[model samples]
Target chain A: MNNEMKLSFSSYSSNESFARATVAAFVAQLDPTIEELSDLKTAVSEAVTNCIVHAYRDAIGMVYITASISKDRRITVKIRDKGCGIPDIAKAMEPLFSTGGEERAGLGFSVMESFTDSLRVRSKVGQGTTIIMHKKLAGRLSGFAR
Target chain B: MGVRFVLKDDHLTAILSGEIDHHAASGMREEIDRKAGQAKPKLLTLDFSQVTFMDSSGIGLIMGRYRLMQALRGSLTVLDLSQQMKRVVNLSGVGQLVPLENSRPPRKPKASAKSKPKETIPETVEQEPPQPEEESRDIYSHSEWENQEKKEVMVHE
Candidate 1:
């Protein structure tokens, strides 16, 4: 079974929870464990937060998310933003290297990378940034089978 | 999300409830800092027992508060974190700077423990056992704070 979803929301901090919740709801059909679901939500939250805080900065823009699940239970999520793109993806992805002032822990990319099986970042200066992540769910029996 | 502050003697605990994200965290941070700064407690405890969901932003909240407490010469501890929250806290290495209540081992009898001092013990060890009467009285005396918390909850809702 293969399914996918696409969502676009304003780059407001309030929408961070909405984006992650929507992705979690969409992926619920895959019968993921509680831990798996939590990992996905955290990853999605981090990505959406990056878009709201770094990508759009002071202005409000749109953040795009596309999530899909494959027959083998591998889940892929792509989050994109159309705002100020990252000047250097490598430095941005480094742990504890935040441009955001004191409040930010600078662990967003690290959290996203650890939560998901694999993470890929693509960005072009003055364009935008895209974060793509993949995680394989444990093959648990469907609810009907139990 | 809202935070309810409880002050007893020189200890302060912030009971945090609801989903904590980047959006809600800024408010919580300010509130906690304001109260902690005013109270100047020797120990600050962040109570997450009621928190339903948290993300990396939660780590930032804890880290920021830890720094605040440090600057004020007070230590901070995070208590009642769910298993999932514990995992996130551990991953961020925030546990090294701030202590987590649930992750601690059960305390041994003082008589037996006195035989050997453990070097691995964290420097910010708990100060003293809580006194129930003093806590209750403090809450009763600080009715204004309760009212403030109620207003905060209403606004968040």
Candidate 2:
């Protein structure tokens, strides 16, 4: 089973929910259980929120989120942002490293890493950042998202 | 963000509803801080029973309140944490700081087929359904994205 898509939206705080819902509804195609759907939604939210808060900061930008489902029932999600990228990807991924200051929990990347099967970050300081996540799901509801 | 407050002497309990994200977090932080300032509660309890979703922003909201309490010489407690909320607070390291009313974390659903990781992040940063946007989104189906040639998957074997 094969499905894929590319979406681009303004990096507005309001769009955070929009982005998560898009990926959730699309990944629902693979007929994931409620638990699986929740996992995907959380991961997407962190990535998109980062784009709105840290990446774009005070300026406006765009975020690109893509999704795909393989025959193996493995789901892949890509969240791309062309705003100011992360300087230290590893430090950013740390559980307690947040640029949002004490007012921020800095758990964005940590949550992303924990929820997804495996997380990968690629970016250059001024170029942008892309977060890729994958997970092999279990079970499938017949005649769902077909 | 549907939040109401219950003021009981030295305690102010905030009953928060809906999924909390950056957008909701901002407004909530203001509302709670203002009311806490006016009421001057010795303990601010954020009631999460009605809250179905929260992201890092939710964590930030808690941290801010904790700091506010500390400065005011008060304390903060988060009560009625759902299992999903428990997992998040556990991960964020805030579960230890905020006194959870529930002694034991909620049990997760049983794993299916292969043994998946016991740890699961709530849907999208614990993605409960995201907040609504000004533009009405169309009813989406999986087929809308069927079979696009663009495929990018990064795996670290």
Number of the predicted model whose lDDT against the real structure is largest: 1
Q: Candidate 2: where is the Cα deviation over 4 Å?
A: A141-146, B103-157
Q: Please state how well chain A of candidate 1 matches the true chain A, as a TM-score.
A: 0.95
Quote the positional error of residue A138 for candidate 2 in Å. 1.3
Task: Output the lDDT of residue A86, model 2.
Answer: 91
What are the per-model DockQ values?
0.26, 0.27
Please state the CAPRI-style docking class of candidate 2: acceptable
lDDT of each: 0.82, 0.77
lDDT of 2 at A34: 54
Can you write out model 1's per-residue Cα lDDT over B38-73, one digit (the tens) per residue?
999999999998898888789899999998988999
Instruction: Report the Cα RMSD per candidate.
Output: 13.3, 10.4
- What would the per-residue lDDT of candidate 1 be over residues A47-134, giving only the tens digit for each residue? 9999998999989999999999887788999999988999988899888899888788898998898899999999987789999999
Candidate 2 C-alpha lDDT tens digits along A58-120: 899989988998877888999999999999888888878888767778888887877789999
